[model samples]
Target: MKDSSHPQATPPHPAEDVLDHLGYRLKRAHAALRGAMDQALREHGLTVPQYACLEVLAARPGLSNAELARATFVTRQSMNVVLRGLQDAGLLTRPATVEAGRARPASLTDEGRRRLNAAQGAVYAIEARMIETIPGERLSRLLEELDGMARALKD
Candidate 1:
């Protein structure tokens, strides 16, 4: 009963073609990016979380564990573990007790800055490679679209 002469008539997309899904593509891209960053950061003796913490601390100077967890899109417990490891490595410092509130603010040690500086080059290089894949004119639009997608899901 269907008109075969109609040009718009097409078969339904197969469910197995996950690559055609926007979420699947986004997830795949994120996984690839994470893997690349992890490999690059490993050479600097830093994990992704460690690098993120240091990067945030370097910019903000002092941030509570909860603040960091939110910023890094991780759980507070995971951030605490990362803080502990970084502290043990002498890359960051936080007082054992807080005077005003329960939150112990964290900051990077001098060594942390040095290490972050060393790692930045490799990280930037990786970013550059990613950016190179997209056209320069479309970069801003792509970023805005990505942000829009995130906001749409978040709300």
Candidate 2:
């Protein structure tokens, strides 16, 4: 017979509880940040997704839709819609394919570059406002942790 006084039990962990709890708070924080970005971009006639695409193209020119999708962490179909929208806006261009039966690779147009440049200050302002209260070291740690988490998740 088992002793009633001694019971098998799991260890207590407030850390595990707060892990998901803090995650929920982080999601809300991200939504707030995204909303601010969306509003700032809207003033310049761009959505957050479109701005992300523009930033990706600006950094790495001549990306195919597949590569762009990968960079944006979006599905190919969603990227196709983004590409079509940007193309329609004359903010991006796709060169005629050099290889047989291949689609043209995409790049940002001069106008797109100029617009992105113009919006740079506002974007920085939004980011700054969000992190302004945070200490530099704390912000650095937060960024490192977030990037590490993202890499882990990707893997």
Candidate 3:
């Protein structure tokens, strides 16, 4: 038998209490963030995919539908629906006919830019609130750690 002089350090988030696995915690965090974004984006008249598409297009104009679908982590079929809705809403534009390749590229309209800029305030606020939960100095380290975790799972 070993001496019980030194006790184990309790984790900040104790195991099985929060389902304390890193992946499960990550999923939980993602779910919460998604829920918050969905509510905020709804007020801006955008679905999450539409907002994501607008954000991506604003940064990189004229991305093909296939490229967009990949960038947004959605299926091409789902992105087709998003593109159609955005087009119908006059938030984005695409050629009526395909360009060189099978997929037509997309660009945001003026209205799209206006809406995205408005929605960004809410989105950034939500992110800022999340960041406030951790120490300011840890913010960059947290981001790097999150990226590291993602890279570790890429295989």
Best candidate according to lDDT: 3
Per-residue error (Å), model 2, residue 90: 0.7
Candidate 1 accuracy as lDDT: 0.91
* Overall local distance difference test of candidate 3: 0.92
Tens digits of per-residue lDDT for model 1 on 37-79? 9999999999999999999999997899999999998899999
TM-score for each prediction? 0.88, 0.81, 0.86
Q: What is the lDDT of residue 155 in candidate 3?
A: 75
Give per-candidate clash totals: 0, 0, 0
Off by over 4 Å in 3: 1-14
The deviation in Å at residue 7 for candidate 3 is: 28
TM-score of 3: 0.86
**What clash pairs does model 3 have?**
none
Largest TM-score belongs to which candidate? 1
lDDT of 2 by residue, 1-155 (tens): 98889895654434565445656768988888889988888889988778888999899988888888889878989988999999999999986556755656888899999888877778899889988989988998999998997898788
Q: List clashing residue pairs in candidate 1.
A: none
lDDT for 65 (candidate 3): 86
Minimum summed lDDT over a 10-residue window in model 1 is located at: 9-18
CA lDDT of each candidate?
0.91, 0.84, 0.92
Best-to-worst ranking by TM-score: 1, 3, 2
